[model samples]
Target: MTSQTTLIVASPSAAGRHYECRRHVTCAMDDAWWKSSRHRMSQVIKCRFLPPARRKRLAAAGTEYWKSQARKYCDFCKCWLADNKISVSFHENGKRHKENVKKHISQLSKRSAKEFKQKEKLDDEMKKMEKAAMAAYLKDIQNNADLTSQELNDILSNGEGSSKLVLVPAPEKVPVWHEVKSESGNYYWNTETNETTWDCPEVYLSLAEQEEQKLKKQENEKAKERLKQEQQKDVYKEVNARLAREKMKEKAVKQPELIKNKSTYTSTFGPAERATKPYGSWTPVVNKPQEKVDLQLPKSSKEPIPVPVVYEPETPRIEFNEKKVESLGEGPVEFKKRKFNNHIKRNMRQKTDDD
Candidate 1:
């Protein structure tokens, strides 16, 4: 079927169209609705567009005279007579034809009403088109060549009516609000309430509105806090400035007073007591602050140590009964061993303090 081909005849008024048909196009066969000569004859005569004279000529389907009329006719309705057919006797007395006739009349009335509305719409559209064309023409004339205001006015008055050109004052544009959804879900500005509200029931709307207002209130609070901070800073600056001025005034007053009341002697106290302190002043030595020091130690402790002591003397002791030299015989004097001379010095200082 795909490889099979057919030729479709084209006309000057219509394009060539390919349609699926069981019979060949050249074969003298009828497969489509309203293609029969009788149906075509009947429909042509019934068409509302035909004149009475033409209807009468095409009404006689079997007659040779009826065959001379134009062959082309397009059927708007797709009714097939197989289910739609009726015996002449039944058709004359049938409920089907009666029902169809009533339906047709009803449909005709509805179509007439629709056509009237469409005609009004088309008339309005044509008027708008004319207005746009006139505007474009006037704009072109104004741009391409120079014309005086009077000439322009005269052209406007004569060329086309400007009273209607006042433009239906451009239909008052209504704000068309659209819904903006986010991760938080649906929300939009309500023009009537003049606030943002949620897409919910009347019961929840107030709660949603409260939430929204709460957010706005929080923002307002933050702004108020910032304003308060700025005011505080300004107040602090003003206070500091005032304090500095007061201190300067007090100092100025004191300067003059001090100058006027200056002492004949520069000393603020009696001469003996007014003497300056010496570089070194006395204080309990324990109370004075001490400097820090670092003392390095041996890296390792050598634990094994020997004691140092001298038990044996180099000279022999003299016996009491033994004969001695004349100087030594006077007395055997004993002497005490001292480790260091600084200890003796410390003892002497203590004695002096005691005295």
Candidate 2:
């Protein structure tokens, strides 16, 4: 208990009146914390006073139990009938409801609406344009018919005046209709119809020039091949120049002018010769047997003494015993050492000296 938070709890008394019972509670929780949340409520319950009821009364006419539900209904939108704050606000803010409001406002006075006036003006203009276009179209057809009649009368007058002059002159002779043949068989033109016919000739000298055109195309193709070869040669030369530059770089790296060659860049061996090659051709030779020298030791008159057998000694066994080892006295192996009696002997000598 380390707080001073007071809470009101309603308790039913025998007098049939609910008392405003307040309790001074102490807790780690803050007094100003939210009273509706679960954590603060649990903390309030642990104070040992009678807890507030699980279901508390909100209000006599709260938002959930409002008798004036008509207040939530929008008067402007008659069909919009939501009975809560969130739904009513959403419906009022919605697009269809906003459009309905606009329509209602526009219908109040058509003359006040600029859009309606503009639409009426557009309709009137369209009708006037259609009528003008129809009248112009009818006038154009009448004018075209009158022009045709005038042209017909003029042609008749001109023909009457030039009839003798046009017929009296002798007609010039055209080249005789000769049948022409080529590698692609024979074909020709008709003089009477002035169209190409399989039976007659038309100079239009294209037949004679086809072979020359084919030869020219062949020459052009050969020229293109020669140009391509020249391009390939140029490319090869560029690649060779690049290779030479790379070789010069490698030579400079390998044999830098520490001892500058007064001679040329060419080595003693040709460019194709391997740098790691031997001076001459190697010959395969047979391996000769080696003669070993005999060791001549001095022989004595006495017989040679026999050597003695060298014995390999065995390591001693380290024994272990199950009995408890005494802290005093000597033991069998080197590891089992006894404690010295020097302290006891020194104490005895001190006692005897005191006596």
TM-score for all models, in order of appearance: 0.19, 0.20
Instruction: Provide the RMSD of all predictions against the true structure, rounded to 1 decimal.
Output: 41.4, 43.7
lDDT of 1 by residue, 88-199 (tens): 3444366766677777889999999999999999798667656655654575577765555667788787966465545456664433333445554665545555444344
lDDT of candidates 1 onward, in order: 0.51, 0.55
- Return the TM-score for candidate 1, rounded to 2 decimals: 0.19
Each candidate: how many clashes?
A: 0, 1
lDDT by residue for model 2 over 76-116, one digit each (tens)? 67764645678878898999889888988878776567778
